[model samples]
Target: MFNEVRRRRAVQRVRPGDGRALKRFRWWQLPFRALFYLRLTRDDGRRTVCAVDVRHWRNNSSGNVKACLYVDGRQHARSGLPAAFPVPGGVVEVRMSAFGLKRCHYVTADGAEYQLVPDGDSAEGRRAHFDRRHPALSRGVGFLSSIVLVVAVFLLVVQLAEQLTRADGVSPYVGAFSSPVDLSAWGNSVVGLITLTASTERALRLRHSWLLDGAAG
Candidate 1:
């Protein structure tokens, strides 16, 4: 129910584009931009390619990290984060997270969802290539990232709870609590770095959980 409401709201944010041509992805933009493509062929021998272009690094400054929808290399529509662009078959949903894009899929009328393919030279594209050539290795890396994120979230929550009890008069009401897993100052910094890396890795695969990746974000 909540998800449906959110999706509807995202759809409401969509606006028609200005008919600008879709620019080519440049190598210098690799670290901040994400580009994906979906080629769909109609029964009439016509084809349209939908492209999702997101500029992630601009989110903090503008607070409007939008997804640009391009059809056949021409600007079609665009919207803020969590965009739902209407296409022929259905809607192409693009959602972002603090680390990177967490979702970019073509959702069909019958409720099926397909992830668009990332550009071959993009970060996501390289990750996809890795998954194809080394399935086991990919799975192993994903598993490790999940484990690291879980551990980081656990420690963060425990430490936060313990500190909250330290406020004046708060300890008397809630009783002082000590974190079972305590880390030194440097250790905490290291954990933060690891959590960021783990979240980024998961982002590449569009894998995210509110509890795990949410904390990192």
Candidate 2:
């Protein structure tokens, strides 16, 4: 029931797009750009390719973050973040987190869903390649990312709880609290960097937890 309502609201967010071909990710655009592709076959046998392009770095300059969908090689639709484009076979959903894209998948009418493949030259593509070529190593990295997120979230919760106990007016009733492994301000910054790295690595595989990732963000 909840999922259905979310989808209905998401579809309403879609906006029309001027037809434009999906651009290849450039070397200089790595930090600012993300592009992903999906291909579906129609009943008559023709093929349609869908691409979701987002320029987060550019968004900083424009003051708007948006994701565009390309059909075949031309832009078909666009919307602000968390877009859902109606495409053949299913809807292509796009969503972002503070770090980067947390979801970009094609969900079919029959309920099957698949994450689109990234371009070969992109960071996501490179990570996918590593997964295929070295399954063990990829699993190890994934496990490590989970571990890092767990530690980050634990510390974050502790810090927040301790801070709450010391709030201006509530301390007299609840009493002040202190975190067990409290780090100096600089030490906390180091943990923030590691958390960012872990979240980015998980984003490569579209792995996200609302509690963990959302809190970290």
Q: lDDT of all predictions, in order shown?
A: 0.89, 0.85
Q: Write the per-residue lDDT of candidate 2 for residues 1-217, one digit (tens) a residue.
A: 7866777777897878888667788877766778899988988999878888888755522355788899888889878767788898779888888888888999998888899998777778778999999999999999999999999999988888899999989899988988898889999999999999999988878788998888789
Off by over 4 Å in 1: 43-45, 58-62
Model 1 lDDT-worst window of ten: 55-64
Tens digit per residue, CA lDDT, model 1, 18-110: 889988888888779999999987668799898999988654234789788999988999888888888887888898888999999998878
Root-mean-square deviation per candidate:
2.2, 2.2
Candidate 2: Cα lDDT at 54: 86
